[model samples]
Target: MSDPVDFRDNRGVGTLISDLIQQVSSLMQTEIRLLRAEMGDKLKTMLGGAVEVLAGGLLLMAALLILLQALVVALAHWVGAGWASLIVGLVVAVIGVILVKRGTSNIEPSNLTPDQTTNQLARDAAVVKEQFK
Candidate 1:
């Protein structure tokens, strides 16, 4: 009868180590690819939101201009045309300043950071450390 094969031999250990190395390498590559895809998706979403906000801001500016002109016209009956225009312009300028301040406050460096990716990477590192240990 043919000899039975020995499964837990030294050669088997070497093969297992080789397979482990290859698998770990492949896992790292897949993780990197996933990270890139996720970041790309996030960037696209952020860009789309920015475009929408820009369009809304432009429309709001147009509407504000029309309203300011209407206010000046209405005030002209009570005040002289020059004073009405000046008052309306001042009010619009003040409102614009307030809006600019609020808009700026909403935009900070932290808001632009890739928070999900950062968290995911930290988790991945922890898992790798545990696996190796």
Candidate 2:
């Protein structure tokens, strides 16, 4: 009877497996880096929007304050008492404080991510599954 051929310790099996693992690991790392980059881009956009909103809000507040002061000055002049302007300024300041309090209470920090990426991926996977069906 012919001796059974030994197939043990095939040439470069370990090296091949190590190379494959390295390739897969590198690919996974690349994907993770891409995700982080996308997240950073989203965050930057959100920051820009927040800055614009802050500037606009501050401008509106300043304008409101100016109008309030004008109204106070006019009222004081009408009443022939310069000291009455201080009362108007105080009232406006109180209203501003209330608004600031309410605005701050409603604010919450957020993580910005693109909308529906996971859902789109799921849909794509379903389509692929259906193709095999």
Candidate 3:
């Protein structure tokens, strides 16, 4: 079991409070810097995903165009060329409309929230409250 805290001290309460305030102020600055760093990391990760998604989208677009063109040509031989072009165009449009969604899923603003800093701040607040009592 933990020993009980001894509140009696040679230092005055006023001095203790002043030191606590200074420490809390310094902690706040550190937390802010940590928040900034965490946010930067999230941004970098998001940008990397975006770049990969963009590259994949471009490659997929090219492949889809080729495959769909071939399909259209094959379909044109069976049905009319006009109908085949229309059908292939509709399919391509639908695929493109939903294409970037998966890649951009990581880029949400909520993901930038500094979870570590928030948790640390909560812990700091709890400690400060305990110290006051």
Candidate 4:
């Protein structure tokens, strides 16, 4: 017959195996936490860069709009018919709207949700293709 197993002594290997399992679990949890922290830091940096780029782009757009408005005003004054000036301003405004819409539509935000990004890209592509034709 096989020897009877001892239940009360430290010599049994069950305790050692349990300790090893626990150690491995703790290490895994630590690694996961570290990975999460690293990913969060990288996301923060990316978002900050995106925000800076967006701010700069908006500032440039504002300056361009102001310049366009000044040009429209000067043209209106030089042309000298009240109705003509109104028509010219309206046409310029419409053209400006179209250009701005096309310009901003091309800007892709990298951090958008996957579905939103895909949908926006598909829509923009369709619009651009239609515009080209």
Cα lDDT of all candidates, in order? 0.65, 0.59, 0.76, 0.57
Q: Once model 1 is optimally superposed onto the true structure by TM-score, how far is the C-alpha of residue 66 displaced, in angstroms?
A: 0.8
Off by over 4 Å in 4: 1-11, 66-133
Clash count of each predicted structure: 0, 0, 0, 0
**Tens digit per residue, CA lDDT, model 4, 6-105:** 6676655787667756865775576556556655665665666555556555655665665566567767676545445455555555555655555444
lDDT tens digits, residue span 15-127, model 2: 86787678657755765666677777777766665555565566557656766766777775765343454455555556556555544433424445544454454665576
Evaluate model 4: give its lDDT: 0.57
The order by descending lDDT is: 3, 1, 2, 4
Q: Which stretches of candidate 3 lie above 4 Å from their native place?
A: 1-4, 72-102
Output the worst ten-in-a-row residue range by lDDT, candidate 4. Answer: 104-113
Local error of candidate 1 at residue 11 (angstroms): 5.2
The model with the greater TM-score, 2 or 4, is 2
Number of the top candidate by TM-score? 3
Q: Write the per-residue lDDT of candidate 1 for residues 1-133, one digit (tens) a residue.
A: 9798666665676887888788779877877787787767666656655555555566457657756776767666655664556566666556655655555444444545667667776887787688675
Candidate of highest lDDT:
3
lDDT of 1 at 66: 56
| Clash pairs detected, candidate 4 | none
Question: Candidate 2: lDDT of 113?
Answer: 51
